[model samples]
Target: MNLVFLYGPPAAGKYTIGRELASLTGLALFHNHLVVDSVAAVFPFGTPAFRRLREQFWMDVFEAACAEDRSLIFTFQPEGSVAPDFADRVRQMVTKAGGTILFVYLTLSHEEQVQRVANADRGKFGKLRSVDLLQSLQADFEACERAMPPPDLTIDTGTTEPSESAHRICALMRDHGLAR
Candidate 1:
């Protein structure tokens, strides 16, 4: 299984672009919020139970998908709130399963991200909608990025349409031996 890991800050279009990328590549889309929202629904966010369940779900899915050789496109927002070793753990699992992980970092200007965060579609997925919250999160972006694996491909979403970005990602995956 090969993983297309889309790493970016919120409102940088990770999920939006992941959908397009999945459509183009035929890979399953697993946005971070899928587990987050489900767990948050049962336990309060940030509580120990919430964190533990969220991590368990992520690990289970990754393990199952890798063992089955199911390639996936996963949307992620790297925040300091999570365990620092989470990314490394995911990488190790994929590699142990003889899979390649392509890290695609998406970014946009702060002004653009702030504007995009307020879109009504975000609320449907329980996305952050406050400009103040965005600002606080973005303030830690550089620090969060420092801990991530260097991106195999980087795209500035502020200037690129989702389809175009997806096209670029697909091309990268093809070059890296993923046919689609």
Candidate 2:
């Protein structure tokens, strides 16, 4: 099994690029919003209950996927040092299942990030779609100095097409002797 973690700030194209990567590699896509949106349906976002449920669901899914020997592509938006405990949990699951992990960090220029956030067709998921909300989120993310993790691969989505980015990621995986 192989785990590919795609992480970045909001509007960085993690979902779009992860979709392309999953298509190319035939891996299961486990985007962060899957859990976030689900939990948000009940508990309000940023509440303690919401956070606990979201984290619990995410870990449970990861554990099951790893145990079943399923390759997966997961996406996240880091809030601080990529949540060391969460990363460690994933590592534990993968290790127990004899799987390897590949971390991909997507990035975009500040201007492009804002533009994408304002895109009419963009999926809001559980997030507020207003420009003011987006700006506030971006500002909060930037204020967290230790949010992002060191990545095995980094893609500038503002300058690359999703298909091309997927191709590059797949090539990198192949070079690392990973099947996908």
Candidate 3:
């Protein structure tokens, strides 16, 4: 039950590369939008109810997967300048399950992030599709990155194609004896 946690700002290519990594490594990809979109379907975004529901759903999935001893690739964008307790929680779960965790942070230039956010071809999840919304979120992302702990690996999506990034991640996993 290994956990590969890929996190960064939205449109940083976490989901895009995660899909490729999962396909290559045979791990389940659980992007943040999987829970976000489901909860957003019933409740308005940013409401307390929506927040609680989203967390509950994420925990449920993580718990179930850990219990089953399954490897997973989880992706998310950490919110502004608060140390991510979620990583600690995941560490505890995987440790209790006798598994290891890997952290991969994806990064992109502000310009590239804006471009990706504006591209409609990206999946229609609960993400902010408007350039205005993304511009605002960019500030939050910068703050989050400053406060977050260094990741095991960092990939710059602005310079790397999704497939190449996935390959690099896979290579790192293998080097760390985490390859499945």
Candidate 4:
């Protein structure tokens, strides 16, 4: 199995681009927000219940993805400092499934991310709880380079057209023999 993990700050368009890439490449897309959004509807943000549900959902998804004999695209925003154990769990899961995992980190200008989140139409999965929170989290994500490995590919979509960014990702995947 092939798994592409797309991660970035909120409203960096990981979901938007992940969905489009799934359509174009015939890969299943399990975006980070999809699960969180679903659970957020009922639970208050930052509650222990919400965190538990989120952890369960991601663990299940990773397990399921491991079982499948197909390629997939998953978006994530792992609080870099949360815990190393969780990341280790993900690595072990993928390794056991005989799957290879690739990381794709997308970054854009702060102004652009804020605009996207602020202007976004809230979906059924819920929405960003606070703009200030998103900003702080992103700043933290950026401050620590050791938090996450250098991505397999880093694309800055703030200046490029959305489609162009998608093309760039697909190109990298193809070049690396991760996609058709």
TM-score of each: 0.96, 0.89, 0.92, 0.83
Q: What tens digits encode model 2's per-residue C-alpha lDDT throughout 1-180?
A: 788888877888888999998888888899898888888889987788888888888888888887788889998887642344676677778877898888888888988887788776666575435678767666667654244446788899999999998988898899888863
Error of 1 at 35 (Å): 0.6
Q: lDDT score of model 4?
A: 0.74
Model 4: pairs clashing at backbone N, Cα or C within 3 Å: 37-125
Cα misplacement distance, residue 79 of candidate 4 (Å): 2.8
Instruction: Compare the candidates by lDDT and give the number of the best one.
Output: 1
Q: Give the lowest summed-lDDT range of ten residues in model 1.
A: 134-143
* lDDT (Cα, 0-100) at 52 in candidate 2: 83
**Candidate 3 weakest lDDT stretch, 10 residues:** 80-89
Candidate 1 residue-wise lDDT, 1-180, digit = tens: 889999988899999999999888788999999999999999988889998898899889999999899999888888766777888899999999999999999999888988999898999989899988877777587688779988999999999999999999989988999964
User: Which candidate, 1 or 2, has the higher TM-score?
Assistant: 1
Q: Alpha carbon lDDT of residue 51, candidate 1?
A: 83
For residue 149, model 3's alpha carbon misses the true position, in angstroms, by 3.3
Enumerate clash totals for all models, in the order shown.
0, 1, 0, 1
Residue 139 of model 1 has an lDDT of: 58
Clashing pairs in 2: 81-147
lDDT of model 4, residue 61: 79
Which portions of model 3 miss their true places by more than 4 Å? 80-83
